[model samples]
Target: MPTSQIAPFRLLRWFAGLSAIVIVLIAWANAWVVSSFLADHLFQREAAVSRDFVQNVLVSDGSINYLTHPDDPELQRSFYKSIEHLSKMHDVLRTNVYGRDKLMLWSTTQSLVGQRFDDNDELVDALQNELVVHAGRITPEIRPKDEYAGLSPRANYFMEIYIPVTLPGTGEVVGVVELYKAPLALTQAVQEGDREVAVAAVVGALALFLSLFWLVRRADRTMREQHTQLLEAETMAAIGELASSVAHNIRNPLASIRSAAELSLESPEDHGAESARDIIGDVDRISARITELLRLSRTGASAIQPTDMVALLQDCVADHQNTFRRRQQELVLDSQVTQAVCTVDAHLLQQVLHSVLANASEAMPDGKRCQIRVSEASRKTVRIEVSDSGAGITPEVLKDVFRPFFTTKPQGLGLGLPLAKRIVEGFGGQMTIDSQPGVGTTVRIDLPKA
Candidate 1:
């Protein structure tokens, strides 16, 4: 209910966890859909551009007829005219005629007019059976380093084309016509598209991440504030229940002591002297018990501190050793523990140990073995086990063990174990009990590393 008991750490952690999940989903979605689509589109567009470039290299009908038929010189003239007509429709760059032997018979470009292309299988195949040879960049096998170096002196440069030429007059079999171009242009286009997709994905992911982070963090802050208020309210309610009982138990004695002291002041005689001393002692003892009850006021869970496990349990043991001895009880201590370093409140933790010890001591009527063991469970936690060979708790009693003032003993105003559980839990530790009807009972406290 009060504003002073709020914590934000829990809320922040929740928000961070959720925001991470959302960002990952966004990134995966972009990769699966947006990026893939862009890549496919770029490849298709590049392939189309290469195809268009190949169609613009027609110059003569003779070249066309030579591709369509080997022995069709008559129709070759009409094919040459057709090629010239096709050339006029688009921007013609260069036209070259190659024989079946792959030598350049004629070329519109003066520089390549007499060039021999016999070694180029793409050209030879197109001239022979008019096979359309579409060649892109030469592979490593086709252009080994030494061989490619002697030919073109650079890598990643090539073209693609359907060459159209002729066989002997079976019909007009178009020779292979290569629409050749440098791979650099197409590759660059594809790479640029990829870069754009990458940039978009990064930008989109960052935007989504930031937005989700902010929203989640804001929600977490609000949730944390609400959770804090809830915990404080719970603590106040628990303390209130215990406080009412404590106030009721101590007030009667306090009033009796006050009335007796005032009466003793008036008398100052032998009759009141002994009675006064008895009343004062009783009041002092009751006040001590009330102080212990007041300490049970829950403060929710606090951060754990690094504490010495051995020393912590030993201190409680030493403090209660005399009480046990006075009752003729056997007190044993074992320090063979796995984990030593733990985070806990020194004062509150000691109180928990003392409370368990006192309860164990009271369980035995005459004398019994009260054993305390401190050992390590794992690297991150220390385990403290306090066991007693006394009248163990029954099922009915165990059910109400931590309920305030649910005492089995006639003289008990039971808030001890409940307060201890609260204290341990507040420090991110666990308190548990295992008991039998008659044999014994063990209380285990597991504290985490600092």
Candidate 2:
């Protein structure tokens, strides 16, 4: 496909990809927050249950004295019985009781008793009378010892909780209780929360994407319609300009021919030949104007040839020398570059040059000087300048000098400069004019070198 046709699709793809990534990131973040909150809630519930069991059942009747003296066979047997019953009821995997020095004083896993856990963050928090919960895979450092290691179906994915044991009435933390349990229920709750968050995010993001896509498509369609209307308007305007130019150019010559015929009819004895010549001249002028219009209407069908610039300019100047003499204008030709050659339609370029010289001469009808300068503008282009010192043009009038059917002179058709500019441009050249109110006007034409 063309790039213009594919650009919008590429843009949409980029927007969709970026939006999808952003939505997924946002959803993942929300899911993580929900899961953390759900997991924490479950862990706190388990910790609370463990705290109640410790306070009401295990240490209710001054069992702390028995825990402090674990060497007593009677107290140890009683403690083991209570722990075993609680473990069976709660489905807890392992339990440990830590004393003030963070040393394990009792455990359902008997082998873990008497071990110290000084560096555990959860143990530290419990010693400060705070409950803490940790979830996820078991680390080698804190895994249970001996046969208790593989007691749960998925022993690795377990919850480790710490609950502080406070003294009744004193509210002082004297010991910490650590509990390990399977996290199957907690995982199910967190997954449910994550699923809810994911659904909400997907729905919201999709709605937003669809809304934006529809708006852009609507705007694109509106722009395309506006563009088509603008092109039609421009085509109509061009046709109007051509019609206006034709009428303006033909009106003057037809009026001149009509006047000559009337004069010849009224006085045929003395002015017969002169009136016939005047009619013929008017007819020729009309024919030339029609030819100019046809040339402007045609596309690039004219053959381009390399022409000697110096010889061409001399011939154009010679043809207009008689008009310059009648106006008493001094015409100066300034050629700086030797062997200046360019590719152009020689006849069309000569006509353009003649029009410019005629305009300059008309601007200075009282015999002021006009200069034509020819030089190499660059290695690839040649420049020609026609400058005249006259009652120069005002900035306001100069602005419309190139508009068709706009004229400063009462009898002017105003097609000369515009047609000249068009002809030059058609040959891959440019024409420009500079004028000052008191300093006169200069027209420059730049054409590519052959």
Candidate 3:
């Protein structure tokens, strides 16, 4: 409630003020439009009333006595009565008749019985049967000084219509019927109201624009901060995974070395030489494991190269050909993938295919043939499928198949599927698995086209 305190509530209040300003501006614009329409409607209504008065009342008797003979008392009464009726129908200031000489013979106001209106040529022309209607400044010189009696000093802002009055019997023009109506007051009032509305509308529009701009700015900043936080979190997760693997992988080699050293210590006389040899072997194994970890972590290690996909797949299947034969299993390769060339790292991709194939072969029951299917799924990708006829992985096992360190085999490290996933993703590809418990399992690797 303080005048200077700026809190979150105050900020939100500022936004509301902006919205209010926009609302005011829109309201003002609508007001202006309505005012303009009303003004136009008023003018049209005034004009229509003036026209109807002349057409129905002034010319109703069909006698031009009011114009031809102003002294004819009988005809004069009818004219005065007609003027009275017209005056009743509208807010008419005055109505009068002018002759060829430009003298006001008669008027609704008895005071202007014989005043001369011989000033403007347009009025003169109207007396000569040239019906004229004009709306603008009126001067005393043109419209006899007494004509503006009982009217505003701004009477010049009035709109007057002059219509030729003709005799009923003969089609001869006798004089003119002039009708006066002022609109300055109404127009000015409406115009003043419009100015207020316009001010409100402008203020509202500015406030709304400012509010939207600030809100968007705030949202953009929040989004950017969130994006940065997400990136950091992802980076930390990767580091954590790397750290875990480093500890786990190093433990095995370190354990092997410790065992070799302990054995040598226990039998230092005869088995010491053999123990030393075992130590060297342990060190070599640890070095190899380190190399494998480094390979897995290296960035851009699987950069693509244009190579024959069919040839690479052929090599992978050939390597497993012996394994299949030794296990008394059949390895059938569908060689319909002749035209399949792709951009890929030949060695890394071969490793992925070979791993899937080896898994497929191992998954099958002894003497069961594992069918290997390789072909182009489309022009943009090559689909390599390895399906085994053996009992497939169960739902629980399939769920964690691709997880790091998850394995079903007795002597397996459970790292094969995860590594395969990494290698495939590195090449901008995907590997998917589908299996049924009692049926068979199919591992499909979809690779990008060359």
Q: Highest TM-score among the candidates is held by which one?
A: 2
Per-residue lDDT over 23-136 for candidate 2, one digit per residue giving the tens place of the 0 to 100 score: 667766876776677667766786687678767776755655554565788876776676666666544787788888889887876788889988887899889988787777
Better candidate by lDDT, 2 or 3: 2
The C-alpha stretches of model 2 lying farther than 4 A from their native spots are 1-13, 59-76, 137-157, 250-450
Give the root-mean-square deviation of each candidate in angstroms.
Answer: 15.1, 16.5, 14.0
Off by over 4 Å in 3: 1-292
Descending-lDDT candidate ranking: 2, 3, 1
Reference-based TM-score of each model: 0.44, 0.48, 0.42
lDDT of 1 at 75: 64
Which residue pairs does candidate 2 place in steric collision? none
lDDT of 1 at 337: 60
lDDT over C-alpha atoms for residue 34 of model 3: 72
Alpha-carbon local distance difference test for all models: 0.66, 0.75, 0.70
Clash total of candidate 1: 29
